[model samples]
Target: MRMHEHPTINYPEYHWPAGKRCAVVFSLDLDAESPFLWLHRGQQVQQLGEIEQRRFGPRQGLARVVRLFAEYGIRGSFYVPGVVAQTYPGLLPFLLEGGHEIAHHGYYHERIEAIPVAQAEDYLVMAQELFCTQTGLSGLGHRAPSWEMTSDFLQTLERRGVSYDSSLMGFDHPYHVGNMVEVPVQWTVDDALYFRYTNSPRDKTHPANPGAVLDSWIEEFEGVRETGGLFMVTLHDWISGRSQRLRLLRKLIAHIRHDPQVWWARADEVAAWHAASPNRDLYRVPAHSINTHFESATRG
Candidate 1:
């Protein structure tokens, strides 16, 4: 398959001059299925498993990820499911106290694209309220469950006061989705897709050698840095928390710290800068790119 290209935006009125060459946005998607698995079994089964449930349960993997982020002094955006927050209120406080941005993932880890607009909107509202009540912080950002989103879904996010989203892949920088900004996260760097897609009788799901994954990511990060572009890595707590995968994460972080150009930042902060900096012009996408779906969806 041909590589995907980023989208281009023409906003002369609001466009700012380019600022930094690249900004790195690390996002942790915190959606797991359990207790409420029966609510959306068909959809949830593809992305999670019972063993994953036991590993990623509140006390096991999630907390470890929280501590890792804190240790790195890197504040990341956590796209959390509302049900997860409700079940583990203490986790919400811990994330807030440690200074991370919380974004809406979904109410129960269900794919919003499969549901009707009215139903999706209701779920989004419930998720926003649940997150705010449990974490004492209102979320203005969203990432769809399983990175599965549609034009209607994006419209819903705009109408519901979500400031940005990070579900789409194939971009090295952030761009606007209608009036809301889209902090594009390259799913190629995402562990979930890498592991899940590679799972076959002939191919192992997890990387045969974790170092190879780290090496690939580091090479991408270095190239982005060379061009003064952003490097965003997406991962799920359930997958990356595994012994082998966790080591890859450590190695990747170490490589980033060793680099002089890398600026480890929260997704929200990257959005803020992209909105404020004149250098926003630096994030241009080729006109013929398929990733221009955001622009096409809104224009239609």
Candidate 2:
């Protein structure tokens, strides 16, 4: 009897530019009042508590975050919603002026599952139009609002010519989702999960300590460095812009700088490098389901 032969599984190694051991992307979701407005759409939001708290990002938090990045000479990426850019006309200009990359987030931090694919594409078009009108540039990167991505959403991204997306958590480094380059993000490293608080019963756990969060992030960075993967930190301006959190971030950046082998880059930079490198075809995932075996697999 002859045995079946299985092909060898290929695990491709990610090679960072300049031969760095790892890549680091300090990304921020520059969501100001867009999330609040989205949540209260079609109704009167008489309460100012959440609105004011979210507004802090635009009025003060963003400036603080930008200043810190400037101090560290880090060109971080800012994912902005169309509503945010429209509400604050100077936002795009300010980010570009700071030598940072402005990527598309959504029209209103929309929940992709609630809207149709056409609506989602329309949101992307609106965001693209806003970016071009304000900054005379096209968006090369996108990170879905709330980190939600469906097959339709990913297809919409491809149709709109978005070069890359940062919402998926498939791989620590860059990979391909259909035709779109994916710069993965982890919830554990996202600032909102640790710092976001609304003063409501929905709050299950208190915000984590800033020092502890910094230590965890540093440990994650070290671990990713050892694996030669990407350490993509997702921060929210409203959450991480506080004085204490900013200090934590500053300390973390200082610690990261101590290692010169990390490729500190923006999301677009990593995506572009990945798309152009041999890794483009090595790590691939389908954007949509290719088979319908889930029902059978889960049936009792």
Q: Provide the lDDT at 260 for model 2.
A: 88
Best by lDDT: 2
Q: TM-scores of the models, in the given order?
A: 0.79, 0.93
**Native-referenced Cα lDDT, model 1:** 0.70
lDDT of 2 by residue, 194-268 (tens): 899988677899988888888899899999999999999888888888898999899999999889898889888
Q: Point out where model 2 deviates above 4 Å.
A: 1-10, 290-300
lDDT of 1 by residue, 1-300 (tens): 334554344434323223344677778887655323735466645654454554463656667776777777878788878777777777677777888888888887778767898988998899888877775566468888878777677778888878778777535567665555778877668877665332335445545466677878888887887766678888777767666776787778777876555667888877787777764555444423344334323543
Clashes of each: 7, 0
lDDT of 2 at 72: 90
